[model samples]
Target: MSFGIFQVPPPANEPVKSYAPGSPEKQALKAAIADMRSRTVDIPMYIGGEKIYTDKKHRLAPPHDHRHTLGYFSVGDKGHVEQAINAALGAKEMWAAMPWEHRAAIFLKAADLIAGPYRAKLNAATMLGQSKNVFQAEIDSACEIIDFLRFNVHFMQEIYRQQVASAPGIWNRLEHRPLEGFIFAVTPFNFTAIAGNLPTAPAMMGNTIVWKPAFTQIYSANVLMEVFREAGVPDGVINLIYVDGPEAGEVVFKHPDFAGLHFTGSTGVFRHLWQTIGNNLPIYKSYPRIVGETGGKDFVVAHKSADAKAVATALVRGAFEYQGQKCSAASRAYIPSNLWEEVKNYMIADLESMRMGGTEDFRNFINAVIDEKAFDKIAGYIEQAKKDAGVELVWGGNCDKSVGYFIQPTILKVEDNQYRTMVEEIFGPVLTVYVYQPELFEEVLELTDQTSPYALTGSIFAQDRYAIELASRKLQNAAGNFYINDKPTGAVVGQQPFGGARASGTNDKAGAIYNLLRWVSTRTIKETFVPPTDYRYPFMAEE
Candidate 1:
């Protein structure tokens, strides 16, 4: 599959002249290609409050067009991971001792830095490394990070100010305090927001953190470190390492000083880490906190009275945004039989209008997938779906790896709910459509529940208020973040807390006060105005 769309120009050393007004073709071309420049920077494993250059180098390539080399990043082994853990442990004492007000200031400063000088570069890297289009990359790399930082700063201040009341006759005061240990934050590659969460939440609550970012996003990750440093964050307060999975996990799980593990990834990996910690429980000094957000098979339901245009727009954006890599992206949709044809026509027409090309092309509605492995995995699923009985590929199953990992935006119609395509989480630009009679709405809901092991996010569209409310309550267990008249992707910072229940891992909602609470272990400090005169209390002395 080839597209003849206008290509985005390479980064220019000087600004180009804008097209004259009333030139439609010129304006269209300009709109189709975003004016963006890629900045080259050396990537290093950050440990012990410093960036460490290593002998091992991994060349970073843009997924949109593999010809563009983002930069060379240093790969860390077990030794580097250990250094990061040590740094985090070393910083724990002072960081935990710092006043909450001071820590909050540092985070606020970091937010400012990210929004200022680092904004453009981080946004560019996101576009280059992750194949996100201009607007999408900006949201993930710039907007989301700034929002998270601001939210964290505000939440920490609230946590700091919370107080306990004392009775009128009481002569003692109670205070809540910070935890005295290190946190291990393991983030994923899908969303740059995860990058912010892994460190900021812990730092907000006065806990030092050792962060191991996904290797696929080393450039943006390094930029994140630079932002933190510029914000006057103390040395060794947050340590970052760029390494492969197994070696990094081993270091994190085996460290004697490890206090908590904050993770977002696969269920298999989460279970493995849980078991690893359990196996080593006998030798550990104290119980370590484990928090995770894993896989999802999020769904959408369209009722008979649903607006066809609204449903189509929601479904297309939800399933194809960021190439459907988000855990909360809708993978399944149930449409009532009466509205099935209209919904299908509207969805197909909208998808046809979607332009697929490189990230630099502003007109490109969808970019490439992350890497070849993901490309192959999605391809295999598509091929398997085609071969299944009564499964029809409505839009796409095309793959072109000559340039990068690009898969066509795909839509499938599954005749039976029992089909594997309808059941599993296809974390790609693929949507499985299931048609159901109005009478079977309840049965369809049950099928949805049983089909997906994941319960991360789901949505319903209906004109009937009672039906919508009933569906919401009935499918309450279906999603940690449920939606009505909106897509599941693009969760706002303070509005909707994100995460899932069951096999989707812990429901630790990111970007909220609840998430910040997970990073710290609270200690209640009680002080008496008058010291006890004797060893025993007055009541005990009378006895």
Candidate 2:
């Protein structure tokens, strides 16, 4: 369709705005938050160019201030799921046939829109709805999402430029076509960038999508949809539906036109969806592409030669940021006996100085958990650790949900390396530390590798090169996004392509060309200049 090979505009990571005192960004975001809180808006499902609103409404409230209602989203059932699928399928032909340059332009424009006008609005929505502080919301909803949009366009162009080499008198061409049908994107509540990326990534490769954001993230998701519409994304290309998992899954998984699934959520849910897809393989027109990034019992291990202060800082920030709701958040740690004392003191001091309150307050380092269920689950772990003989409740185990779902940053020091808190994926601000003999560094690495079924993210802290190498070699398979002396979370879009294997879901690294390849089915064409008139070869004549 194009006369010449085209290059997409070069991409750069969006600069993260520091909402410091007296800053314009700070004032703008605060005004947006105030504006959003002043009124309760009605949200609708966007399907095939239509904003479908149903009678079944679900009220959305902030996790840090549960009583204050933000807005209400129209909840749909399985029928709406079917409608979303049909819409995606209906839009597939036109969307796919559009020139790739045009597609790239749309998303690039979307990035500009997000980086400019929609920045404050998106950040405010995330702060109010998902209870992320200003910085967390800025990095996630604004900067990260902007990076995803811009970088993905460049990746798409890179994919198309990849072609097979042709010999003399013949032309070889490679065509990267979109999936046969449509993609179904199921995103989690923890990340706004991820929610936007899941659907748009596939759509950028010319596929249509039915996107289902987490119910708790609907407030911010609606803002993303607004951005998409403003950026000129055609109707039915990416349909947004608000529906429960089971009802949506039953219809989506069973549909023959379901081309692929791009997901981010729990390990359990990913497994269930994979099983359903496998069982329904016979009904599908083609083998559906399954891609997911799931749960993690992420870890932070410090060697005897590691700096105590640095290790403490990593644990405090990596484990407690965003209330430890991130899948890559550090949940467990193994500290050498010689360094445990100093690390403990530093961690305790940091926790003591931290404040816990709503997201509006900039001084509060810790906020409430996502919802009542998450709060209770985290609280249950803290309460159980208090009673367990193998673990000691070292710092911050107070759980008071009277006003909001607030649980203090809790820590458990365990004698047993395989203690419940150490092994389980508690998606909250609960960290379990186990002290090991200084000589047993290698042994502790082995234990860490085998303790958790997840292999999402983990870090090793060591000033000694030999110790770092040893841990890296020993725990090679323990994490997909392994760190040397840094925190496991805060993966940038283009720099660190994220995802993990084992119980953490498929390791098809997102934020890279590798992920874009999944949404496309390539076709190689060989055109010969000269025709073969004879049926027999030269060897036949010799015979």
Candidate 3:
């Protein structure tokens, strides 16, 4: 069925009233307030040089409290996805042939526009659409988008300027070229920054892109496209579509023009895509590039020497940021047996103080889960854990889905790693803690390695420099991004490349030069000064 045929209704709840003037919550709500003051733009699906509005509409509601509808978005389906891919294919040659400097300028302009006019709106859309708290949404959706754009522009310039070394007696040079065809970028809903990365990275390298954004965050994705268009990204260079995963994956994987697949989602989907591409290799026109960041069951290990308060705060924030929906969220934590009591006390105190409410309430720390399915999934996990043997529900079992999908911040103490709660990824504001003897730290690490099929992100905390160094080296291969004394989620773009290995991902760090290199193809150019005036070789001439 086409997306145009599915008409979503407006949210049932009334609009939220403005917070009281001069109140503490009001002051804390600065970002949301600034966002509300900004203009609300209507979103349209961009395809084949046109901005199309559909009769089918989807409401964008705040996750914290569903009562507030942010706006309505146009929904696109399978046909729409195909059209977008076709458009990207049609524009591939012209865009790929464009001067590198010119393309960089366009991207830079788009970055400037996002930083200027679109900042607040983008933040607000993220808060309402994805359910991020004001501060988190502002940084990820607004600031991070601008950062990625600006960084890519600079990186592209460097790529263009780089030259190959000349051999002592050879007159040959190597040149980097754009991919032969269009790239398909399938992004996730957890981070708005991801929405920008899928298209911008490829476009910066002169490759046209067909972007299939997550349905839940279509409004924000649409706004990002508008910003790009306004910045002079030519028609058809970047095409945006809103479609469900399976339908879109089918079209993208089977298409002849699909040059690359940039994905960030579940491991199962990534594996399936890999297998499907493998099966299609014989019939495929060319070898397509596959880059993905999949699932993660990140962990934080706290040694006896670690600061109990600091570890507790990092664990809480890392586990609950964006309601713990991120792939890098801390799902499991290991504590030394001797320090378990102190860490537990600190964690409980920190979590208890966390204000639970809508993002509109500035004082609120933890927001709601994305939707009803997410709410139910998390609730089911918590309920199961509660009844499991030797599992204590430290906090949170409440859920209020009236306004939006809301789940209380939950923590569980598991008697052992054998419990499902310790191994699985909850993907909510839920954390499972296990205590281990300090001397068996290595053994505990081994246990953690086998706990999940994923090996994405993990951290270790200790005051003993030698112990920390030993653990860091031992766990080096276990996590894609390892932390010394901090959380794993807030990876900076330039310094540390972000991504996981094994089932977690292909380890293609999003903001690094390595990631940008994947979007390009290398070409060797050689010119002969004299077009072989004689057919005979030098040895024959001497004879």
Candidate 4:
């Protein structure tokens, strides 16, 4: 057998199609959801290609209607985590030694599977499990996942092709080598795309992974496992476990083979892991790479000359989509006092028009929050705002938890920019607004920049060119993903390269080349054209 020089095709974002009523795509997805909901799926831990069923099981239910049971996934403890870690280590050498082209082909095949046959299945899983509407599922589980796989493969190729410069007498070749040991991927419940990407991104670079998905997202995670197996990813290359945070960390952090952690979840969890790793540094063989994308207190600031209608629309879509569970979801806003009345009315009109219910109904634009805990936390804030004289509940102060974890799209009107609602990350469909004097644009811009500890995503709306320029320069470090005249939420792959800094995460920029760099260590190979048989040089002889 012989090999040819490899070339990667240009990467492009997957086109998102609307699953509107009476459309064939809508019919197919509805059918998929029906089929999935009709049966109770039983999920087990996958270690070294073996399906291990634990004695303990946890029931899975949709957040929209919590009483109905959709499936059950096996509950794992410390022992299962150990088994998963060992499995990843067992497969490390072979996977790392495999030809780079073969490794790339596996994820490419998975991308094709997601784009075609598995599209409806995964999208339906996300809708039922995560309470996302039809469009949300399409863009998240289907389109974004496809883009991650394809673009990551292209990114891996780019890393591999990068070479060190060579002198005349020596040929220097650079090799991008995978980490020496296994990686741990702790993914969040919001995006099924992130769930898939967090693990597969490092695996695409030939490193083995022990993946632990958020309990709320196991339904969709199981579908990804099937896709990977169907696409022929080798056994033990990427192991899936169902252990919780502490259980997984106890086993993974203590192991000498722990080489990296790819995380996308709460900031608290990532920081705890960092602290644990730091305290136990002496036991590990190498300093593990910690890459995490965490919580965000995202914002949108509008200048006096900004278009009222456009600003209102941005707030509606950016803050309410996916029930405002996204890390990049806009939770705070700053508007000049002059335009506040008009913008507030425009926002209220949109909020009143939104219909909230189960994602099975395409007419419903908003769905429930993930689970009971998230529901209670958001409800508490709305209740507090109702009582506090410093703040007023402008819209959506209602919440009902009898059938599902549902909260209306709420907006809080506050006089203080330093209010708790403006500074904290609610991670729900709650937007806190601070109306400022139009003349204090610069001062309010600085206040908005300094309000939150997180610097994830932010936006500005302005018709004045100089004002826009001033905000842009002043708020440079305020967000990793900044938007002008657009919402910060719908970041596309290859185009936006999503991530953020300080408290939000490491800001490696997922779906791009920078993220792939964290997974591999480079080695330089130098070959001398002429061998120096003699030991001494001219300078040494003269000396």
The candidate that achieves the highest lDDT relative to the unseen native structure = 2
Cα RMSD, model 3: 8.0
lDDT of 1 by residue, 166-199 (tens): 6554543434444556788888887776887787
* lDDT tens digits by residue: candidate 4, 1-543: 218779877778999987767888888899999999999999988899899898899999999999989999999999888888888888989899998889889999999999999999999999999999999999999999999999999999889878888988899998889998899999999999999999999998989999999999999999999999999899999899999889789889999888999999889888999999898889888889999899899999999999999999999999999999999998999999899999999999998888999999989999999999999999998888898888988898899999989999999999877888999889999999999999999998899788888999999999999999999998899999999998889999999999999899999999899999999988888999997899987887653
Candidate 3, residues 1-543, lDDT tens digits: the string is 123322212112111224357754335446554565354445778887898788888776666656665567677777888888888888888887776777877877887786666766676677767878766876687667766777776676667666666554445666678787788888888899888988889888988888888877786787788788899998888888766778887787788777888899888888998899888877567798899999988999887788888788888889988889989999899988888888788878888888887776667788888887888999999888878889999888787888778788888888878788677777888888888888888888777777778889998888988878877877877899999899878875665678999889889888777788888888876665546567888787653
lDDT rank order? 2, 4, 3, 1
TM-score list, all predictions: 0.91, 0.99, 0.91, 0.98
Q: Show where candidate 3 strays beyond 4 Å.
A: 1-42, 168-170, 530-543
User: Candidate 4: what lDDT?
Assistant: 0.92
Candidate 2 per-residue C-alpha lDDT over 1-543 given as tens digits, one digit per residue, 9 for 90 to 100: 889888887898899888899999999988998999999999999999999999999999989888999989999999999999999989888999999999998999999999999999999999999999988999999999999999999999999989898999999999999999989999999999999999999999999999999999999999999999999899999999999999999899889888999999998899999999999999999999999999999999998899999999999999999999999999999998899889989999999898889989888888888899999999998998898897888899999998889999988999888788988999999999998888988888999999999999999999999999998899889999999999999999899999999999889988888999999999989999997888998887854
lDDT of 3: 0.79
